[model samples]
Target: MKHPLSQFNYCPLCGSAHFEAHNEKSNRCTECGFIYYFNPSSATVAFILNERHELLVCRRAKEPAKGTLDLPGGFIDMGETAEEGVAREVLEETGLIVEEAVYQFTLPNIYVYSGFPVHTLDMFFLCKVANTDSFKAMDDVAESFFLPLNEICLEAFGLDSVREGVKRFLKR
Candidate 1:
């Protein structure tokens, strides 16, 4: 799938096409002398489970993983802490209020769609839902439901980094 912002020929900084790859991390523009690099953005994910040990998963309503099951998460906004972002993303995507969470794991991965890099430093946390009755699909989510951990197919989700984090958490 093509990223929505992948059709640009000019540098975002100075609107020049005279750009050169500086390394695996960045690009340098010869025209306006601007450097563009693949900087890893921080993202937070939540593993919210019920008393039955079923994990809450949401069907993505947006790109990057549309139609696939994903743990509630999104980019950490500027000035927001990791914990704050995790809780906000969960509420925004699944309408589930999360409480009592602990950091589980951190994964570094790169997502490339249509040759554009989406480098992410993903932070995962295990949280308990405060009010399941409030759960409802919201922005960027088509639907939300719970599934047993063992029933979740990691390969089908297409989120290897998140799957690994869940696996590690379950193992411990």
Candidate 2:
């Protein structure tokens, strides 16, 4: 795997070509004395189960993992809490308003976006919804459905963190 900052050749702070690796996770610009560190972004995932205990799942409409199975969550925005981000993501992708979200676990993942590896700390949540009647696939989701826990295959999930997360979720 390439370094997360491998795509950069110039320093954004001073437009300096003297930028070089400062350490494993940072780069220093020799001309401007600016250091850029690579850090993981915060993301969220939801494991919503209906009364029958079927987990809600989605089909991705876009890459990184087009047409693969996914959960209803995304990156947490700058000013949002993890609970708020998970709820918003559930609403956006599945049209289901989350009444409550309980934090479960977290997993570190490398999400490849536009050929760049983005490190993320994916926080998992077990969500609750008051109604499923309004559910419809929206946003980046191609379709949405619920599957029994026994029927879910880890390999069907495209994202590594999600796959591992689901495996851990099921075991618990």
Best by TM-score: 2
Query: What RMSD, rounded to one decimal, does every model reach?
Result: 3.6, 1.0
Taking all chains together, each candidate's TM-score versus the true structure is: 0.78, 0.96
Candidate 1 residues lying further than 4 Å off, grouped into runs, are 1-12, 30-34, 112-115
Report the number of the highest-lDDT candidate.
2
Model 2's TM-score against the true structure: 0.96
User: Model 1 over residues 1-172: C-alpha lDDT tens digits?
Assistant: 4332344457888888876665655677889888776568899989888878888888877777678877888789999999999999988888777787799889986665565677789998888878765688899888888888788777656576777776776687
Which pairs clash (backbone N, Cα, C closer than 3 Å) in model 2? none
**Model 1: worst 10 consecutive residues (lDDT sum):** 1-10
Give one digit per residue, the lDDT tens place, for model 2 in 98-131: 9999999999999999878999999999999978
Clash count, one per candidate? 0, 0
lDDT score, candidate 2, position 51: 82
